[model samples]
Target: MKIIYSLFVWIIFGLMTAFLTVCGMPFVIIGKNPFFMLARLWSKISSKLFLVRYEVEGLEKIEPDKNYVFMGNHQSYVDIFSMISIIDKDFLFMAKRELFSIPFFGYAIKHMGLIPIDRGESRESLKSLFDAAKKIQEGYSVLLFPEGTRSEDGVMLPFKRGAFTLAVRTGQQIIPFVIDGSYKVMKKGAFIINPFRKVRIRFLDPVSPEGVKDREMLDIIRARMEDAQKELGSIGAGK
Candidate 1:
């Protein structure tokens, strides 16, 4: 029964996503918020599709008018949908360069100002960071996974400093978002849904770059994000 339900939901979710993407094409080309709105749509649809329940805490801490460099933990791909569903703003996503190669979606990302980074190319990463800085300067927020990649064991990995460096260099606020239980739902090596369950996402208070040097700021954000993940661990467990 669960398998039948999963297959049914997956088909419906795909159709809805395709429909939304086509409908939002105009807004995406016009540099509007439709692309971001599509994310919210996908998130809601996906939750129902996967039979997953999620709760977000501490959204009030995010400032409305200011741009933020949101550094988050890498758990599962679901984290992207979850965050977009919670935030009521149009923020750009900092993702791998390879994602830009996807046919129609890549073109849409380019139009909507998503910055792609080539992790192996320092020069390209630098260029991407500058582009991200420019976006923040223009009043757009950016999301970065500081851990760089998903943690295979559900343990926090050492964070890369690039996201923090961008925040410090651009002087944008660093918002740490801790995601828990995504791996248990959709992990690194698993594509088949096991048992549907609940997940928790906690948004910690944003940090300012005030008087802090760029070199050491990564550690600060990493500590806060890690601690938040640990706190979420106490609230629940996943099968």
Candidate 2:
């Protein structure tokens, strides 16, 4: 029964994505942003289909009018959908270059101002981060996974420095968010979606980059996330 339900969810998700992509093209053509609208719609639909419940905390700490560099730990693909469903802000994703190569979806994200990083190439990756900094200057927030990829074992990985560098260079405040229980819903390298899972998202106090070195900023965010993970009692917390 779970297998059948999972299959049904995927089918619906794919169809919805295709439909929304086509619908968003008009806005993209006219140079108006459609990501926030379509992304929220997609996320709301997914929550219903997947039976995933979200418990978000610390929204009061977020100022809607201010742009930030939002960094978080990655565990599953569900993390992306979950954020889009809850965070009420206009933010762009700094995704991998490969994701931007997908046919229709790629075209939509590219035109919607999403930054793609070629992680395999240092120069290109740096260039992409600089471009993301420009987007931040334009009053658009950016979401990045400092782990750079999802953890296969539900354990949080070490943080990367690229996001911290961007924050310091742009003097943007960093909002470190922790996502718990997403790995149990749909872990990396898994296709089956587990329903009725409770995922907790907590936003930590914003770390200011002013007068802080990039490495110092990185340590601050990581220490906060580590403490938050332990507090949430997430899987692999002590490991």
What are the per-model numbers of colliding residue pairs?
0, 0
Runs in model 1 deviating more than 4 A are 1-7, 27-33, 234-239
Worst 10 residues of 2 by lDDT: 230-239
Candidate 1, residues 1-239: lDDT per residue as tens digits? 75676577667866776677788887756767566666677777777677667878989988787778888787877777777777887898888888778655566566668999999989999898899999999989999997788876677777777787788988888888888887777778665664576778888888899789876887777777767776776332122
lDDT of 2 by residue, 7-121 (tens): 9998998888889989988887797878668878988898888899888899988998888899999999999888888889878999889988887778767876889999899
- Compared to the true structure, candidate 1 yields what TM-score? 0.88
Per-candidate local distance difference test = 0.77, 0.87
Cα lDDT, model 2, residue 183: 86
lDDT of 1: 0.77
Worst 10 residues of 1 by lDDT: 230-239
Error of 2 at 176 (Å): 0.5
Which one is best on TM-score? 2
